[model samples]
Target: MSNYRHHSGYCGIEVRDMHPRIHNFTYVSSCVKYMIFMLNFIFWLFGGLLLGIGMYAFMDKWHSTGWVRLETFYDVILNISLVMVIAGVVVFVVSFAGCLGALRENTCLLKFYSMCLLLFFLLEMAIAIMGFVFPQNMNSFLEDKFTDKIIHSYRDDPDLQNLIDFAQQEFKCCGLSNAGYQDWSKNEYFNCSSPSVEKCGVPYSCCINATDISSGLVNIMCGYGVQEHSVAAAGKRIWTNGCIETVRLWAERHLYTIAGVALSIALIQLFVIYLAKTLEGQIELQKSRWAA
Candidate 1:
């Protein structure tokens, strides 16, 4: 009789432990689902942010250069940004819906959201691939726009010769003296140096002594010239080239990184969908068993 009583006590203890164990699992499962939903939502937010930045860049400066062919190409790229914005919005909405569905263990909504996510992910991959592949052409477009600016600036500046003389003195070259001219050569030293190398042997450097007040004054007072404008133009060209080159390099270097992040987000969403589906099946099974 005592043995029977002890066995009953043990069985009671076992049943009590089982309830808490099952309850703990239920709590953990709920937490996991919430975490998965939150992750999907965060990735959706990231996509939206990128889309916004791209659109801002497309619309801000690039939109103003419509007179240049490069600007025209930049405008064309605006379409790509627009598409990204649309895609991001769609993904955000669908992912938000998916999160809600996951939280509620709704199978149909989960499936729909998964399909949308997959479609958009593929679309983004295609766009990224295109950007990576045609980076050189894009860089050329940026370069052309910058070169156009230089050419325009050169044409517009009336005091360009003075500017060139001033810049030459700043560089500490011999001015017209270095060009082997007793007086500044009318044709060769008109703009500090000859444009045609064949006509003038070596161009004169523009260094003038302070004691030689006339040459110094001439440099200071002269209008903008080819040398000054060309220097400025070259600087602008280098900056534009560097900007385009950096962008191209980034696209090339990070093509796989971008794709991987995108794909990882999609995979995570898929996993969440799967987990939600499994939970839905379990809930149904529990209902049937309870009814039985």
Candidate 2:
């Protein structure tokens, strides 16, 4: 008599627990449990992929995560990678716990998963706030790091060399010293002050336009002696100014987009945490009903 009864859902304005107080009745729907399980499964699948990629990138950049030697100027170079790896590790672990909980319907794993999600959500929101509030800190650090020292030490690391070349080409700027590829002087081969064979030469990245983008058709000589000419004469031949000004300007222009992306990530994590909490609550309620 208590388990079976007739009742209308009150104009389709359903009440989940109104009858629980009136009749001590409870409902545990397998559909809701399965839905939450599947959601966690999907979330973990994508999270695993992101985690793997982030770890790979971090390892590749530092060779070993042990002691990443960044001189004083390069100290902040690890900031981005460190945050990403930390976030990636947390997401992976939470997702693993979620997978175990969903598959086994274990209360302990679900509780851990929910708690981890909340903790990570709060941490990310804090970081996003700091990132937006003081974006200049990052910009200044990068401007300092991307100086003539890179050109002088470019050959020391293949990764650093590639990054420097990419930055010059993308920003359409040149040199550590002044404009018109004079910055090339910092490199031994292009030391115009010493009058070497490669003196006054610029890398192909400094040209107004590349001969080939796909194949990187470099006129090693295209940059040759271009810095010897006056700025007016070199206007058509090579880029002027160091990357600092242009890159800073670019960051200023795109600052809003960067902040928006950070906010969006925070919102997504908040939603995920909400979902985990709701599922945990529902599971607890279902357990109570089963015991009754």
Candidate 3:
């Protein structure tokens, strides 16, 4: 068996990382072959989807670029789109390797795919554990790094402005903090003591119903002077709470779904890693058998 293994090119290449116990003398087990192929195909579809949406969002931003207040309007949305594009490209490359490796029973490609999956699994598990243990910390981190950027750069990009407005309205929330309109003071136009004509007015998104009492056509000024009112009075006119709490509440409501997705991805990575290891062992065994 050692002579046969040495004569064959497979074990000579690398048995260091292959599974210790060989389950099959032939190539990959039928179940592992089909299952890994299917998983890879599913990932391929998901990657394509991410790539498509990323490009679509990027193009939407490009089309709306002329409407932005700034001549150069690169911001979080653009950054997110680019991340999606890069993630999609990576998924495609790794998943394609898995698909082809499983189909052709290539041990090197299988090990490479396994390494990628193991790395992903470890990173995902670490993130999930950290997020679970420090949800508040995660929220605070995102708020400072992400929400603050969005708020400060709201008018710099029209797309970001529209997104913030939608989020505020949909969540029945206003500024980034529970302190409410105080945070809007960050906006030069909405600053409570600003000399500008737009002082003391929140965005139209903060207003309840968002319609003029008389004209009833969408009231662009519905949130005008709302920030100047007392909290009790403002609560009647608009959402007095801030987006952070509402977002936290929303996340709490959907915690199960989020956890399930995180666990599912991690488990899938683990499963791929196992299959790749088993396939590698089988490939080495098959080469030995062929030599014998």
Best by TM-score: 3
lDDT by residue (tens digit), candidate 3, 119-152: 8788877877767788788767766766556667
TM-score of 1: 0.39
- Which regions of candidate 1 are displaced past 4 Å? 1-32, 40-88, 128-233, 236-238, 242-245, 253-270, 273-292
Superposed by TM-score, candidate 3 places the C-alpha of residue 238 at a distance from the truth, in angstroms, of 2.2
Please give, for residues 1-292, the per-residue lDDT of candidate 2 as tens digits: 4544455577976444434344444343455456557776776776777777766765776674454555664443433454455666666677778777756667788789878877777887776665556656754654466555667666554455676678788889876433436667778877787557778777777778757588867665667787678877776877877776676578679988876887797787676666656666766887886777
Weakest ten-residue segment in model 1 by summed lDDT: 174-183
Candidate 3 displacement at residue 156 in angstroms = 3.0
Candidate 2 regions exceeding 4 Å error are 1-91, 105-132, 145-153, 175-202, 212-216, 225-235, 241-245, 254-260, 287-292
Clashes of 2: 0
lDDT by residue (128-245, candidate 1, tens digit) is 5556676666556555554334222322222333443343444443222212221222343333455643232112223222333665442322222323343344233111122235
Query: RMSD, each candidate, Å?
Result: 14.4, 8.1, 8.3
Q: After superposition, how far is residue 40 of candidate 2 from its true place, in Å?
A: 5.5
lDDT of each: 0.48, 0.67, 0.76
